[model samples]
Target: MPRLWDETVDAHRRAVRAATVEATAELVHEHGLRAVTMSQIAKRAGIGRATLYKYFSDMNSILVAWHEQQVTVHLEQLVSIKDGPGEAGARLCEVVTRYAEITRSSRSPHAFDFPDLHGHEHAVAAQRRLRELLGELIAEAAQSGAVRDDVAPAELAEYCRHALAAAFELPSDDAVHRLVAVVLAGLSASDARS
Candidate 1:
């Protein structure tokens, strides 16, 4: 009887996980992360609060899972661009642009949105990985002379990231591209004509 009970519990847990993913994806798509709530997810999933809690400790866990999934997709995209033939700046621009597009398209939740991961180990690790990748790419672009050397590669990468992420708030893609050019210019050597 105990073994049978354990099996049933495992099945229930699996069901809740599937429901959580579905509900989270839907809520984020429809209402954005800020508007999503634990209670709403539970109701949408047609599961009791207790059942939801049994599978996920809270909304933060679910959001983190979603972010992990998104990151997996983004990583694949980055890998393809990293290997693609092109100027370093163009490739880097492609990467940043795609990343910005992905973020803009989704109402997906960010790591900070989850209270449970506010200072979580996994969150810190993920951020570190992101910074390392950004820094490497920026440094590469600088070495290729496509980006200026005055500013640190990591700083350039971060600036590009921020600009792209906030692109939607800007008036146009032209504006965003111009902003990127400005950052690149700042990194380049001074313009001197003979």
Candidate 2:
């Protein structure tokens, strides 16, 4: 039953990692990055410091993993939106709007713009995939005469990504929505009436 034991051990490790990441997110939300420590996370996760170290070597590593998990969830949300109903332009607008709202409302630790947040090679690759997906969606919309033809698809995608980040700085969803509406308006085809 060596294989069964190994599987059990793997399952336990996964559970611990999930718990640690979740605890870190909660602490980060309540206290911000500076106030969160490994000891705090261990206590929050209801584990000893030694057990915490066994799962995550340090706070920075835990933060990186947490950030990755958040990005993965965001990407999945974007993909699901793209997969949903309506034309590409409408779908894209909905996706961007949803992104702005979520970022503005959530207590995620996106304030620091940490390089380790999305700078790791694997994280960067995931980000690239997200950009690519956005670009394709924008290009399709542009071809449909929905979005401005002058703006390059990649450029539009980059702007939207930056806008999503900026939206997080807003104090309220209404303010973020107004800003997003302006961006969406600018993306409209020239022939379309305001």
The lDDT per prediction is 0.69, 0.81
Per-structure clash totals for the candidates:
3, 0
All-Cα superposition RMSD per candidate? 5.8, 3.4
Considering summed lDDT, which 10 consecutive residues are worst modelled in model 1?
Answer: 185-194
Question: Which pairs clash inside model 1?
Answer: 148-187, 148-188, 149-187
Model 1 TM-score on a 0 to 1 scale: 0.61
Candidate 2 positional error at 182, Å: 1.7
What is the TM-score of each predicted model, taking all chains together?
0.61, 0.79
Q: After superposition, how far is residue 176 of candidate 2 from its true place, in Å?
A: 1.2
- Using lDDT as the measure, the top candidate is 2
